[model samples]
Target: MTGAADAGAPLLEVRGVGKSYGSVSALRGVTASVAAGEVLCVLGDNGAGKSTLIKILAGAHAPTEGTLLAHGVERQFASPRDALALGIATVYQDLALVPLLPVWRNFFLGAEITVGRGPFRRLDVAAMRRATRDDLALMGITLRDVDQPIGTLSGGERQAVAIARAVHFGAGLVILDEPTSALGVSQAALVLRYIARARDRGIGIVFITHNPHHAWAVGDRFLVLRRGTSLGEFGRDEISLEALTGLMAGGAELDALGPELDRAASARDPA
Candidate 1:
């Protein structure tokens, strides 16, 4: 059995993973990998199997075919908690934070820190607040006070909080789904900066998004999907932003439509 002590092993591995619901197949033979301090960005349009793959990884659903490996050992998670216990934390676009709750409280919502070594245990509010502030700052997030409600923060700040929460809970692999989809350009860049900060801390990240631009920015590896199957995978050294975007949208299709699109635009503009 491969344990967490295996330094050379990948943090998570999806080998030939597939899922189906009745006659509808959601995924097909998807194989991907992530290691410490790396970002594996998964790109695809809606209904292209991104959520299905996340479900499998998040332990919300089991793959009908293929295997999930953690640290080189087969792992079949019966529930999301099982995945969490194995140091895998998934943060979706709709973050789970209770908007009205204080930032520190939300940070330690489910897993609260306690004082007293023995039976006189008590909730450690001061410690949690201090820790939350420090952790958030580690990701370049600053808050005026830890006692403020989480809802008062901006979208980017909330995303950073979720990330910091995950890391604080001992997660080694952080799977983020569409983190920057709803943000403006500057906010998206803020999230990307935090992603890089996470990488610097040696946590492997699986970033799932439909935005080719965001994926190409901080991603170390890229996996593009179409029709529920990966079109291809590319390393940082293998592709640039322009090429990656072209391929993500089907390069051949883009090329074939270029002249026609240009003609249509010219006709409309009379220029």
Candidate 2:
């Protein structure tokens, strides 16, 4: 494996990635690339290898076969922490917020700020609150206050907070798994707005979702997966929403279903 700053580098690239469990193939020869400040959306139906692809990228599981290049260097991450250290962070659907904890506390949970002298060092509550408030506001998420419990925030707000937290923590590449899957239409829209905000901040994002509409809303590039393989990948310029939806749901099969149904109806007509 090469370092992340090698030649012909993409901000993040997975070439010919494959994953298998015993005799089951979870992924097969999937390849994709995401550049800086771009949103690469991976769209797939349930069991279409989306999770497998994400795990590989997050370094949760090494691809049975493939090369992962970050910042142009080939690298293999031994664990999720390894990936995070390289500035890659993953936000799963759960949001991973401690519901009982205060918003500010959850924001700075593992990486708390401290200040004061020597043994007197104490949690920098004021600094963390002010920063969290500002960061969330910058991402278009307004909180009543940072002292409230995280569970009080809407799903979209929670997701936005997670995104802001990742960006503030120096994540160069953020992989989001179904960030909007559990939200309603308007709530999902709010989360999507924050995703765009993150991209505007120059952090490359990999958005994994089953909703083509949501994917199209924030995606600069699209990769459609099916049956553990890539159906295709297209730039926004190369594909439309209708085309993408058709592909994900089996275009040829859909086309054939209509005509076959029409033929059956004609045969049943009495002259």
> Top lDDT: which candidate number?
2
Model 2 agreement with the true structure over 166-198: per-residue lDDT tens digits:
888878889999999999999999999999998
Which pairs clash inside model 2?
3-73, 4-73, 9-72
Model 1: per-residue lDDT, tens digit, 162-253?
99999999899999999999999898999999999999999999999999888987899998887888777788998888887887777899
Once superposed on the true structure, which residue ranges of model 1 sit more than 4 Å away at CA? 1-5, 116-122, 259-271
Q: Let me know the TM-score candidate 1 reaches against the reference structure.
A: 0.91
Instruction: Report the Cα RMSD per candidate.
Output: 2.8, 4.1
> Lowest summed lDDT over 10 consecutive residues: which window, candidate 2?
1-10
